[model samples]
Target chain A: MNERQKSKLVVETCLLAGKIMIENGSEMVRVTDTIDRISHNAGATEARAYVTLTGIIMSATPDMGSQVTAIDKRTFDLEKVSTVNDYSRQFAAKKISLGEFYRCLKRMDKDVKPFPFWLQMIGAFMVSATLEIVFRSNYTDFWAAGFVGMIGWCIYCLTDHYTDIRFLNEFIAAICIGFMSILLIRAGIAKSADDLIIGGLMPLVPGVPITNAVRDTLSGNLVSGPSRGIEAIMSACALGFGVAMAIKILG
Target chain B: MVNVIIFSVCVYFATIGFGLLINLPRKALNMAGIVSLIGWLVFHTVNVHMGGYLSADILGTFTVGILSIFASRYKKMPVIIFNIPALVPLVPGGQAYQVMKCLAIGNYALAKSNLIQVIFIAGGIASGFLFAEFLNQLYLRFKTYIITKKATR
Candidate 1:
């Protein structure tokens, strides 16, 4: 393919990949790679496919995440561009993958100081701790912990959307979970307080992420998988320290 | 005073479990407080009317777990979310608070006792949870194996 054709393919692929990400909660890289593979399957050369993929990624732009869920389905299905490409364009316009968009965010890095992960952790902790405080019963502490967990998850989701890096978000989540557990223990800490503390930390547990990241890396996804594993490990360490400190200092 | 505290605490935890199970909104989740008291009443009646030192807690905790699991399934929510809610009533936070308070006041003996109690409680919670989860996994695996074997035969 010539330069012009390669550029067109890239733009088309990026838009299409973005659409798929929104509908399927898929990784942007994997989605794009699949499209690149398909193009190759369709007889495109490797070098041209690479350029096309790069172009598609560049064209995805910022603001795709917040916009993805907002656009109606009809806008994506134009008959002239073929249904798939039309849908892809719609995804591009709607901003399907926030994280991927942020991958391109450094191009215009000024004026966007994403909310610090620590503050979000504190806020999530507050919501969770309060619930445990009010409900001195069996379910009270657990509910509070879950609430806190969700808060951390939400913050991470937003951060992951913007930066495409999971490290800070996971750390923040771990801290929140740790704080929630300590709060639960300090508040009603009777014979069964373990249930509360342990339960509260469930959401922020790094087990799954750590396991998956390692598994992926071992299976040959160094770029994507190991990054996730490292993030999980960091988060787990943060959580352990946070709990120890809270218990020691507050006591 | 302890009775009042018990009633209120039970209600709150129950509310958390019920709200989670039902997939209610944020505002509705708080209602776990109001309804769980009724559950507490069941325990209270069994102990108070019957004059038993039954601790009502064991049954109550188990009830929360069973109900919370059911609630999550019904609500179409993740079990992880509901797991915390079910554990709300069993946190032993009060004991922990008392232990810390004793230590703060330099009552070392009482603090020591409370600390041991805290360990016991946490340990009990973990053991019970492990038992339940293990049993469930075993049962599921056995059932699946039986079904598969029968199908092959």
Candidate 2:
């Protein structure tokens, strides 16, 4: 390829790497740092990257000219993020060529696998059951939490597939969890639904987002910080509202 | 005590399952579990001594932050993989639930207190991480400065 073409390729590749990282839930500062590093090592004299929870914008000024690329796809997959980090570090160390790096990134994008549905359901049950133990609940609560939590997760998976609206999906998941908790209680499966419902909702809570929001604020990314903070609160509220709806309607 | 150990063990396994649900790598799942177990242990231990929820939250997260940095370096992986899942156990899940439960029941007073408590806990955890990161940055700068000074001499 010609020098100009290669520079353009580098910009595109860096943008792709940044996209993968951001979509896979990397921190905002880390996203910018990785993008700049990749572009700089790929022969860009000047590189700038701006990332938020929703999307990423990057520009690279190589000797040929300047190029900008933006992508708006966000998901949470840490395996992909880790792979991108490794690839960037290797590329910066001159251990990998641009073409090789590009190929690696494409493979990383496609290669990361989520746990199977059954496994995730089991995991959901385990999470809630153990949370009951931590909450000092009785054995009956533990069993009921497990059963209800798995049902809640099944509901979550179903809704998550049917809709791309995250808040709505979470709201529905909480409602399902609350409904199951109440059923368990009525069936004499458990004494109270409070701990069971809380435990069941544990998996859906936005723990990582809130933690990242605080970290972002402390690191001075004002826009991303408050935006993520609001996102966390909204998700929490959605889950709460769903549970409340279930209680109000069922009782 | 046995109670603390039991709580930590429960947290450890729960975190492992959480790691699985989040699709963390196998090695990372193990490390995240350990990191969270340690965080829970620290929180309980420090709470026993200090008798305050906020201080325990801070100390617990502070320990997790340091361990995550070390784990990231050792495992040749990003710190986020370890930190996020590990922070799960300590993430004020209980308080958040209480806020929602109270709000659902129309107990605005109880909901307000729960919301404030969640804010404080989240703040404490964040500050702990920030402090650890600050210290880590300082160490890196000091090491580089020493090396450069020696070279100049």
TM-scores of the candidates in the order shown: 0.36, 0.95
- Fraction of the real A/B interface contacts present in each candidate? 0.00, 0.75
Best by lDDT: 2
- lDDT for A202 in candidate 1 is 39
Model 1 chain A poorest 10 in a row by lDDT = A71-80
RMSD of each: 13.9, 1.8
Decoy 1 TM-score against native = 0.36
Report the C-alpha lDDT of model 2 over A1-251, residue by residue, as the tens digit.
Answer: 98667777777787778778767677788887887788878877676666666666555652344444454545567888888888888898999999999888878746778888898888888888888778654566887888888888788878888887868888989989888888888888798788898888878867667767877888899988898788788988898889988887777
Worst 10 residues of 2 chain B by lDDT: B1-10
User: Over the stretch A1-251, how does candidate 1's per-residue lDDT look in tens digits?
Assistant: 56555444444544444443323222223444545544443333332222211123332223221111121111100111122232333344664432333333223224222235554444344434443444344543545565555565565556656764435555555455456555655576433443444444433444334323433443455664665556555765564454444455554
Q: Rounded to one decimal, what is candidate 2's iRMSD? A: 1.3
